[model samples]
Target: MGAAWEPGGAGVLALPSGRLVRGRSLRALPPGPPPQFALYLAARPVAPAQWESRWLRWLDFRLPADPGAVADALREAWQRAATERVEIACAGGLGRTGTALACLAVLDGVPPGEAVAFVRERYARRAVETAGQRRFVRRFGGLATNDPSVAE
Candidate 1:
């Protein structure tokens, strides 16, 4: 449950329930299979040093003005969360981070329509605090809500 999110593109944070919430740096693809579970955040242009990574696979891209990365991350997150793993997606915590959280919320059984509010209330009061980011959350795929009305 309660875990401090370290500053980075995205990472895997272990929740109190022993779940792994993975964070990732939003970039392009390198032609390969996506991670087991992940959440992507589409933010502004990233510098070269931001591109630097040793362990996680780097999806090469200057930056993002789209939701491709977020979608991929959400897909992974959904798979992991289904197994009761703690999945997280963040971009400096707040805007992009909140947006990714909202997507994760949807994957965690929150209604696609109310995913933004769900993330904001549970993850952060300031989650997805932007029009563009909100839009991304609304459209993101990959979800597993417990609410029968919204479950898929």
Candidate 2:
């Protein structure tokens, strides 16, 4: 029940540490086995899935509403990626999903400044869409994660 995703599979992003996490669009999910765990980024929590999932309050093209929770959820996703099929998803899967993937890159020891690029090169070229999203990824490393503001 803990088989990880195949490295380089569809939507799978291989981190510097070799951990793999998939980023997908909730609206157009890929054809494959369901992830063992998923982190859903949307304005409202998604309906429960066959596998375990955690829904974060995130709006499209915006940073997470709770930075600390984002950190924790990403850490959990990263940890599970070691031995489980973990996926990050949003409605369109480019902005919020990509931003979260970049944050996961940061957690995996890629410098925050380079994390967005890392994800774009490996995941999606147009990832982390907005300036605020990019700013959030840039500051993810230094911020306290709790009570940090990324507005405007």
TM-score of 2: 0.91
Model 1 misplaced stretches (Cα beyond 4 Å): 1-66, 82-91, 142-152
**lDDT by residue for model 2 (91-110), tens:** 98899999999999988999
Candidate 2 clashing pairs?
none
Q: Please, what are the lDDT tens digits per residue for candidate 1 over residues 57-141?
A: 2222222343443455455554555453333333445566566666666555566679777655555566666676676566554
Top model number, TM-score: 2
lDDT of each: 0.46, 0.87
